[model samples]
Target: MKIHLSYGKDGLDVEIPERNLAGVLSFGASTPLAHPEEAIARSLQEPIGSLPLGELATKAKSACIVVCDITRPVPNKQLLPPMLRTLEESGIARNKITILVATGLHRPSTAAELDLILGQSMVSKYRVVDHHASVPGEQSLLGETKRKTPVYIDKRYLEAELKITVGFIEPHLMAGFSGGRKMVAIGCAGEETIKTLHSPRVLDDERCREGSIDENPLHDELMEISRMAGHDFVLDVSLDANRNITGVYAGHPQEAHAVGVEAVRRSVRATLKEPADIVVTTSAGFPLDLTYYQSIKGMTAALPVLKKGGMLILAAECSEGLGSERFTAMATRFGTATEFDEWIHQHPVDIDQWQLQECLKAVRQGEVVVVASGIRPEHRDKLFVRTAASVEEAVAQGLQKFGSQTTIAVIPKGPYTLVEVSRTSA
Candidate 1:
């Protein structure tokens, strides 16, 4: 079997294993990404036509708040050109438009980082500011949820006459899929409101154990919050392995986001359904494991498809594992979910963060586990059966222990595991 690789926009091709995967199964054969820019442009064109960003901005807009996806690698750099051009044509002047980095509790990106995501030219002209979640006064508490989660948000966003959200569509740790309403929900939402959703109780773990983004309650709530927030229009993007826009969905939040989901599902989802005894995989790449607060998706993908007591093999490069100090502190302060929640019952903070501690409890038992990543060996020992250097090695170890009769499932990226959930269910 031969796997092909190409660099700098040529295309990627992987020779399918000729040997009958008869009992063996591999889902996504590396295929060429043909006319990527054109594909993205076409998807975007439809929504651009509908919203007519230029026309709307030219009309009654006082101040425009352009909230950008400031998370890790997805800085909206590539899409910013055309999007800015549209805004300019639509009549919103550069000065009146304020660029917001919608980082909801994550550390704010620095000036150089912002320039990298939004290019030097654009960053120079537009007055941009990073959203501060820990700080007070700048952002206002819109309200609290039934669960008593507070919504800390960028006050400027609500005040703006026209609001434009830009982000890339990908798998999210909490949300089944990312983008569109996701921007308003987790991206720009306040800590309390987000906690109401992110907390283990509200998380859609068991609900979509074998379900897709469509059926997930987490995504459902995002849609609700986004609608109430009136995000107006969104430019949601989907990228290939190299972070190129393989698909772009633009328009009102609900309308075009589905396109992003399908495009990513094609390239990123697991192919086979039969339970695998030895599964070898990676984190599905970056942004998924940007930090542990964000790393759960990869685990979600492999968990459901494994047999009743099958072994799971994971290869994740969590170079920056557990990215948040608060997140790490929360994890260590409590021994169990019950204790964790009890702690939350008393102490008051911006967001109700105890829910994530609860979400962590679901994986304590079941089948055997194996992991090889940048995370500490102690952590691996605590979570998995073993850890190895490579996928082939992991598989070999698995076969030695579980026997060759076992199946194998591989996911290059864990974040997009939702695709496999539905396939496994089917």
Candidate 2:
């Protein structure tokens, strides 16, 4: 059987023998929108739970539109033009509108990346700036949540008379799902605010897992922060496996995001009859798999369908290497996975530590075999995982460890496809 997995830009297809396959887990197929631009315009015209964006823009002196950074697959190019036009048509001058890249704790997008993200026309025409989380003085402190998560958002985003956020809706490892409030709470938050949100205490909560919302404390707190940050409006899209926009949600951040979440839930949720002895997955490729830190999402997503002692074969290009210097430093500070866990339990204050801890949790589940061209031989040992030159070699290693009769499950879109073992099977 030939299984095609999402890899950098173009995708990767590997041939696996049918005899060893258990089942290929993937999201339900959804037809891509025939007219995404029209859909986006229509959605903005009749937004949920509020007046149309044009009407709202009329009252504004200035506007700040927050967009996802390079790490996300948000269709900024398609979404931004219509939004900018809406604001402009309402008499808001182009200079009064600023586009803020919600980098969170991630690095700033470069000039070429900015052009790719927002199109050269938009980038050159509009005043686009990257959020600097490290600069606390530049942020406005918007009180605390019930969980006492200090919400310090970018002053530009907070000070805007008209605040709008543009993002994609998808299952997230920590926030249940991404988009909406997340764009303000975490995306535009300062470094300390981000640390508080991703702290071990919050991340350890049971409800913090994927596809959960109603009772998710993390999600609830983020919403609280969003309210405090005064997130006026949001435009979120749901995409199919091929990155085509399938649905668009606009208007009130909470209301519109909920709609987008439901749409995404239908596309990505999958159920497995039983845990697999070996699970093969990818990090959704290209922009998302650019770094190992971001690629950890694939490992966490596989946990629900992975046997206690199963082997996880992860394929991520990671062309950007470790991605986070802090995360790599944390990994190097500990010798073993257990030590890493212990350290996190004691000192969970650092940025990106939570991700490393998640990586350690996956390590405790079983052995992790990684296949990536960018990872060096020396770095493999430091990452606490076995390295392979290709997915075929990793699968061969898994077969050797688990024996020929081992059940194998493949997740082609990785974190994009959420798999949960059926309760009956569990």
Candidate 3:
């Protein structure tokens, strides 16, 4: 059987022997909007749980719109035009409207990346800036949440008379879902705020995993932070497998986000009858798999359907190699996942450790092998997991470990597809 996995820009095609194949796991079919641009316009006009965007803009002097960084495949070009036009037509000047990229703790988007994130025309026409979480002066203290997580948000966003966030709803590794308040709470947060939220105190809880919102402590904390920062409105969308707009949700932050989450939940979920002895997956391609740190999401997302001691194979482009200096240093420091996990528990939370912490979850579950061509030769041996030359070689190695008859499952879209086992293995 031949399977095309989401990898880089063009994707990857690999042939697997038919005898060992369990199934090709993928999202349930979802229809993309026939007229997405028109749908977006209508959504802003008849937004849920709040006044129309134009009316909200009419009452404000200055406005700020937050957008996700390059890591996420958010359709900023489509989401921004209607919003910017609405704010400008309602009296806010071009200069008064700022477009902030919610970069979180990641490196600032480069000039070329900014053009890719927001169109080049949009980048030049508006005051487009990346959030610098490390710069203290750029953030304002908004006190703390009920959980005592400190709230430090971008001053530009907090000071704006009208604040709006645009993102797409997807199953996040932590914080349950990725849209709504996350675009502000985490994206525009200061270094201290970002570190505190990602600390083990919040992420250690199992409820913080994907597809869990109501009981997710991280989600609750983010909502509290957004409210404290005065999150005014949100325009979030649900995307089909093709990355086409499937649903457009606008208006009140909480209400609109909740509606979008349900729509996404109904569409992207995939279930398996039993655990697989061997599983192959990807990091959902392009910008998502650009670095090894980001590729960890694909591993954790596949765990629910993987048997204990199963062989997990990942194919990520990792065009930028590992990740941030902090993440790269910490990731290669420990020889084993247990060593890393123990050290993180004893010391204070450092930048980017949470992702490694999540990565260790999959490591503990089973052996992991990666197929990445972009990594430097010297750095490849330093990885905690094993490395492979190609997807075929990785699968061949897995077959050697578990034998040729092992049941194999494949997740083509990786983290984007919410994979779960329906029943306990006998």
Best by lDDT: 3
Comparing 2 with 3 on lDDT, the higher-scoring candidate is 3
Off by over 4 Å in 1: 1-49, 62-75, 144-150, 208-215, 262-269, 332-373, 376-397, 417-426
Q: Give the RMSD in angstroms, all C-alphas superposed, for model 3.
A: 1.0
Cα-based lDDT at residue 354, candidate 3: 84
Each prediction's TM-score versus the true structure: 0.78, 0.97, 0.98
Q: Please give the lDDT score for candidate 3.
A: 0.91
| Winner on TM-score (2 vs 3) | 3
Per-residue lDDT over 171-257 for candidate 2, one digit per residue giving the tens place of the 0 to 100 score: 888788999999998889999899988887888787888788879989998999998889889999999988899999999898999
Question: In terms of TM-score, how similar is model 3 to the real structure?
Answer: 0.98
Better of 1 and 2 by lDDT: 2
Rank ordering of all candidates by lDDT, starting from the highest:
3, 2, 1
lDDT of 1 by residue, 60-102 (tens): 4544445553344564656666766666667777777778777
Predictions in order: lDDT: 0.57, 0.87, 0.91
Expressed as tens digits, the lDDT of each residue in 82-112 for candidate 3 is: 8999999999999999999999998989999
List where candidate 3 sits over 4 angstroms from the true fold. Answer: none
CA RMSD per model (angstroms): 5.2, 1.3, 1.0
Candidate 2 local lDDT, residue 276: 87
